[model samples]
Target: MCSRDLKTPWIDLNTLMRGQRRVLLRHGERPYQLSITRRGRLILTAADQDTDTAAAAAPPGKARS
Candidate 1:
């Protein structure tokens, strides 16, 4: 829901997340992690490089938080 005179590109979660709770995005050598919270909120953070950098949508792990 945007109201502006200028134009902007937007991507839906269904298309972006692709039915998963988490997805890894890469820009240059940096890795970004996008996650869906338990409250149905969105969070984007720098991902750990030591882990997998496959840039795939992964099934959410057990997070009671």
Candidate 2:
């Protein structure tokens, strides 16, 4: 591996979260949620990809009957 590839990639949580309570991260076909809990701690967990994607794909204030 090149020396550049050996370096660790890192970012500050505050910069990443950016005042948001949660952010969705995609890993290939899978989706994961990164969130700040009420206690100010971080949590990472698998999200329901199908449901989340569908909801996001939906238009604002629109719903399927």
Candidate 3:
């Protein structure tokens, strides 16, 4: 769905975040959240209120993991 030709598998944080603290991604009936941590790290997880929060770490050197 990306329009620009990507030389490498990389995306600008500013562009992706779009100045928001969190972004929601919908898949069928489930919604996932992409958020910025207090330490300026990135986290992606299921957005269900009752579900446990599991965040995958950002790539090495991208943030303090």
Query: Which candidate tops TM-score?
Result: 1
**Residue-level lDDT for 19 in candidate 2:** 61
What's the best-to-worst order under lDDT? 1, 2, 3
Error of 1 at 55 (Å): 9.7
Best candidate (score: lDDT): 1
lDDT of each: 0.72, 0.66, 0.63
C-alpha lDDT of candidate 3 relative to the true structure: 0.63
The regions of model 2 sitting more than 4 angstroms off are 1-6, 51-65
Cand. 3 TM to true fold: 0.51
TM for every model, in the order presented, reads 0.69, 0.61, 0.51
- Candidate 2 collision pairs: none
- Least accurate 10 contiguous residues by lDDT in model 3: 52-61
Ranked by TM-score, the better of candidates 2 and 3 is 2
lDDT (0-100) at residue 34 of candidate 2? 77
Residue clash pairs of candidate 3: none
Per-candidate RMSD, Å: 4.2, 7.8, 8.9
As for lDDT, the candidate ahead, 1 or 2, is 1
In Å, residue 25's CA in model 2 sits off its true spot by 0.4
